[model samples]
Target: MGGERGSIVHRITKRVSQEIEEDPNLVLINKKNADQADYLIGGGITSFDTYIDREKKDNRKYCTKGVFVSIRYQLVDVKTKEIVYTEERYIDRQDTREGSAPHAIAVVSDDIDMLAKQIVDITRPHEVKVTERIYLVETKNKDFKTACKLAKKSENRRKAQELFAKVYADEGSYQTGYNSAVLLFLNRDFEKAMEEMQAIEEKFHTKEAQKALKRIQEEIEYQQKPVQETSLDSMYLRF
Candidate 1:
């Protein structure tokens, strides 16, 4: 868990471990016997890029500061010795607080939680399934104007409506399609995932959609088979 911004990353990791400890559902194995665990989720902040500029208000300099922490990690399968997942992300925070550790944490707490959940979800994917399903259902039924109003009035009715929403056949809207594409990309189906992303880009015309398109395209290109180089000796000499 060492990195350029080692201390902050360590703090975030410690907090995440504390969360896992407090959570009833997660089974955290002892470090000594981590090899016996089914999967390993590990990450640390690789770099912290920060900037500050003065904003003059009332003839006084007020600094507008920001930091982008690039976190990198890999998930490995204990039994198979396979790298199941890897990700690099930049978590950005913009705040009035200057270059101080306490201020950094204050500005980035939410971002830390969000990123921590991502790693934790990899550690405990099953726990996130229900949450993902709920999100998907909400996405589907979000445009139901009158129905959404009525459903919000009663908890039971809302739950029932959500359940009913899940049963509807998906017409595959933008969010749903993007989610599906991401799942495919995660599963290493890059070609189909790229197709889905392209379709989304054509429809949404958003920067996020364009980013997804770029990522999948990069993955696809990177995964293509490389041409073996031939040395002069190999070309001239007989085996």
Candidate 2:
């Protein structure tokens, strides 16, 4: 490393190591801790993929190498026994070195580190958002048939109205807001989704609500960079 390395140098290494460690540890820990704690935990990586590009120097040229890795994961907590996390991590590793093998490794490693850190930053929050989403979905699905039946077949119209109202009025209202925000987020409407979330904060100041909203916002911002690339791909597909 040169000149004690820059701040980013440390970041790069710390990130890669952290990702490597956390990726595996989450699975083992969640499995081990599932029954013992107040919360049941489950985490696993379903898939991992990597891409690399290399340009060789002509003995007189500069070369650059880049790697991108994506990790897919799902995690659940037991007390609720609900999926609390679903997220993907994307990392980019890049190196620009003349012709040295050591320099090449250093560059690639540094890039991996940088990418891994980015992955962590993006994924952790996304996990929280997804978990909240799952909770909301579960709530909505729990009494659907009963609620619909009461709404449709109650002998007293007034009673049916009341039952229907009671059943569906606030069912997952908070989750609906959060879920709408998630769709907006996927559509790349970050600002509006955030504003929608702000209203949730104003209305329900619960810690869970706040945490859920915060997690969604963080993931939206984290994934924005990739969305740009995704947009380009979509355009190509359209053509």
Best by the TM-score measure: 1
- Please give, for residues 132-229, the per-residue lDDT of candidate 1 as tens digits: 11123454355433333433332233343433334332454555555555555655567987887788689878777788788777666644533222
149-193 in candidate 2: lDDT tens per residue?
A: 332322322333333334435663654444444444433456776
Error of 1 at 186 (Å): 4.0
lDDT of 2 at 145: 37
Candidate 2 lowest-lDDT run of ten: 230-239
Query: Which regions in candidate 1 have their CA more than 4 angstroms from the true location?
Result: 1-4, 55-61, 97-103, 127-183, 191-213, 217-239
lDDT of 1 at 124: 54
TM-score of model 1 relative to the true fold?
0.55
Error of 1 at 137 (Å): 13
